[model samples]
Target: MAAADSEQIRRRYDRLAPWFDSLEGILEGLLFRRLRKKLWSQASGGHILEVGVGTGKNFAFYPDGARITGIDFSPKMLEQAQRKRQRKQIAVDLAQMDVQALDYADNSFDTVIASFVFCSVPKPRRGLKELYRVCKPGGQVLLLEHVLSSNRFMDFMMNLLNPLVVKTLGANINRETLKNVQACPFRNVYTDPASSDMIKLIRAIK
Candidate 1:
């Protein structure tokens, strides 16, 4: 993906930062919170890295004693996350960083996590490769992502609407994230349906 595209996404997210939580509040209350908990529960809680930690929606779910570092490309989004962190007194290191170009050293984290993030990343495969790079040899990669549906009609609709969705929300509605994860160096990849077949709980070993 081009640098311009990545910067565009960052700008879009920064613009959305103030309204993001309220915009997704209903869905979060009804479903996302449960999925977040399930995803966090799988964490080994040792030197974790969370990619695209937007507005710190997962802050409440961080495991006890987990050494966490959360990164995002949008500074405004990180600001929202920081406020939440302070209010909750969560122990997390927050940074402005891109998943596709992580600054961490090789084999740096015990667990790497990304939730609802790949769809917005300009280069999903590149981001996944970075996750594989930063994670320890035996560490885990946990993801909660929504993907293109297997149903032909739904897939077609998603493809049709994806451009508009991305333009307005800075997130693509039709990403093939599970396949992207498989294409990376990670091993023992596994997926389970978190909400129908479209939304998946993907787990892989690094």
Candidate 2:
């Protein structure tokens, strides 16, 4: 669940939500859409849970006929996602929920997915544990995230900018999320660099 800083994050995202779709659209169109498409297309038909589903950006990328439940802690962000869902006629159950403590029972979902979310989580490992707990045995967990770069210059730049970035955007630019995922209780962990080793597409099994 959210910690003491969660209210700050919520306020930040709530403030950002009004214009976030347009800004994210421009950004994703320029940089992230292709990788997101590739990653989301791999999703098979099943009961899917998407955590931190900001503006429902992945709604169009999911395979047709797949059941989806999308959750986010930010209600304002979820409102945008709901609008997009209506516009696209995408069938999804949207909820305002925290990731660290999922409301669902154990082994409830066939697949769990998140995109660019862990960097903003106040308690990432706890959130990851929840994902593991809700996912049925043999189900998959997929994530698309930006992490600290392997390149010295890029890593240094990200580190230098991280505090301000987190303050302003509620997202850390230098998170070692893939490493965190590897350390979690998941099996068959696989990672592919999605952008010059800065962004990664990760797949693991519960």
The most accurate candidate by TM-score is: 1
lDDT of 1 by residue, 117-195 (tens): 9999998998899999999999999999999999999999999999999998889989999899999877689986545
lDDT of 2 at 51: 94
- Per residue, candidate 2 scores C-alpha lDDT tens digits across 156-185 of 999999999989999988988888888888
Superposed by TM-score, candidate 1 places the C-alpha of residue 32 at a distance from the truth, in angstroms, of 0.6
TM-score of each: 0.97, 0.94
Model 2: which residue pairs collide? none
Cα lDDT, all candidates: 0.92, 0.87
Off by over 4 Å in 2: 193-195
